[model samples]
Target: MSEPLVSIRSANLFTPNGTRIWKDLNWDLFPSEIHALIGESGSGKTTLAYSLFGLLGESWKYDFLHWDVLGYDLSYWSGPFGEELRGRSIFLVPQNPNLAFHPYRKIKDQVIDFFRLGLRSSEDPKEILELWKEMGITRPEEKWNSYANGLSGGEKQRICLSLALLGDYRILVLDEPTTGLDANTEKWVLRAIRKKSEEGKLGVIFISHDLRIVESMASRITIMKEGSAIESFPVKDRKIEPTTEYGKELEKARRFFL
Candidate 1:
């Protein structure tokens, strides 16, 4: 068995107003695996996505949050190192494309800016255009020069995914990335993701509401609700249903597990 790339154990967080956001959350990710995080909206799935990249602002306090990545003990990464690691090691494709770039800026410029700040790997527009084409963003030339507001929701998402893929980040955090995408487009996107994970040895935290997609892609599943992880099980496990309340709920809600 491969060693885990990242591990979170007994982590707790709270809002600034002292409202508990999550309690005793535990998860593990191994290389070349997809960890699907599924939950209803407002269930803190997005918050967990941000937390993985150390992007959660100071408005939230941690009771005892710690993460171990690649056998290194990173203590919540509250400093410059954490911020750097956020881009270099963990890339986040936010739920809202509106938050990823300036509305007036061209997609090319946004990708350039992200390339500069993140990974610092390359700035070739050709490579960027290739990624755009690969993600099924048609007419790369037109899409590249278009402003964020001009593109539809699905286009914006694929563009975001393309930009994230340009980097060599170890873990890619995608929050509801396939929303608003048509079935064929969504399948293409998922196929691209699978290729990245298998060929690049990348670990992904794929957050989605679609149980079918999760069943197909996730090597393991984590059930979250109202900020807490209630159930976790491996797809390869012989067990049929999750043992926790939320897990059982999910079991009843979706025809999971083959």
Candidate 2:
């Protein structure tokens, strides 16, 4: 069998104040799979996405954060190793793109910086310009040179996603890519993500509260609650049954929460 693209094992997380949250938490992302990580607000779904890149918040701790990606060990990577890992191995698109870029810098410069950090090949300005057009940003040249303040929320999100795709990463983690997008943009973004996953280039771990979207996109489903993975199953299975009450409710009322 092929190895999983990434794995997290023996993780026991706790709040920074010394409150235990989960014990022996584990999960895997197989190649080319779209794994949906779903839960209500404050269930730690975004934290789990952050943990994959060792971006532990001030209020979090872990007994062990053992992780591996594409045959490279990142369990204890720090300093330069941590920088390289984040810049190349795994990519994360935050729900809020406002914090990702410097307000004072041009978007073009920021994207070039990302190219330098995450890529090893020679940079071609046209490549990013192409990405700009592909990401649905009209007038690529103008948008490319504009700073964050000049872009709309959906535009910023698309630009951020475009940046994420430029990296030669094995896994991509998305935290609610459709947060503020209009229906058309949302559909386009999701279609782009699904197309990428289907191309078998990398695995994607998508964190979202939208079960309807998850139902259509995910090859496997994982429901998390209170910092633990309460349930998980292959989406292709003939029957999916969750043992937790929360899961049952979520399954039954996919639209109510959204």
Candidate 3:
């Protein structure tokens, strides 16, 4: 196996009020692989997503016995290097797509600004347009001029995915990225994601509660419960259900597994 894109062992995260939100977390993700983190709400899945790029704010404290992401040791993550790695090396697509863009700015302008930041390796507008079309945006040229408020939820999600693909990021963290999409749109989006991950050698951290989608997309999965990882396993060719009691419960709830 190639080197992991992210590796964390004995990690913990605490809120500003000193309440522990994550406990003893151990996780790993490798290049060109889709690793799914699945659990119910408040399981700290999204918190883990934000924690990858150290976006949990100063008040929140995070500690890891071994912390590394995209070849950088993040055990003592802070300062200029931390600031530089967030959007450039590790790109996160928030659960709420609205958080990704300026509400008042046109999408075209924001794309240009992101390009100018030198986060992405390529500056080709045509490539961006190609991704838009692949994401099922008809007449992406016209959509480019519209504001964030103008696009539908699915469009916003796809736009964020496209930006992540175009950027130079090695790891893409997606938090409930397919939430608002219809079945057909979801299919297209997933196809595009698979294409990009394989072609670009991107490692994807897919956090979603929907087991059906998780089963379809993920090569491996980690089950989280109350801020802890209970089990992690390969899903591609396994005929039996997960071994852990919690994982069995999850499988029962989902009614099926790959």
Name the runs in model 3 displaced over 4 angstroms: 238-240, 255-258
Give the alpha carbon lDDT tens digit for every residue of 1-258 in model 3: 899988989999999999998888999999999888987788988888777766777888877798887767754345567876675677777899988889999998998877677666558888888878877888899889999999888788888878876787688888888877778878877877888889888899998877888888888898889999988988865332578988888877875431
lDDT scores of the candidates, listed in order: 0.78, 0.77, 0.82
Root-mean-square deviation (CA) per prediction = 3.1, 2.6, 2.5
Candidate 3 has its poorest 10 consecutive residues by lDDT at 71-80
For candidate 1, report its TM-score: 0.87
lDDT of 1: 0.78
Q: Tell me how many clashing residue pairs each candidate has.
A: 0, 0, 0
Best model per TM-score: 3
- Judge candidate 2 against the unseen true structure and give its global Cα lDDT, from 0 to 1: 0.77
Question: What does the lDDT read for residue 39 in candidate 3?
Answer: 79
Candidate closer to the true structure by TM-score (higher is better), 1 or 3: 3
Cα displacement (angstroms), candidate 3, residue 200, comes to: 2.7
lDDT of 1 by residue, 1-258 (tens): 788888878888888899888888887888998888887777778787676555677777876566777555545465677876676777778788778879877878878878778665668888888877777788989988989888888788888787666777788888888877778878877888888899988999888877778777888888888888888788864233578876778767775421
TM-score against native, each model:
0.87, 0.88, 0.90
- Most lDDT-accurate candidate: 3
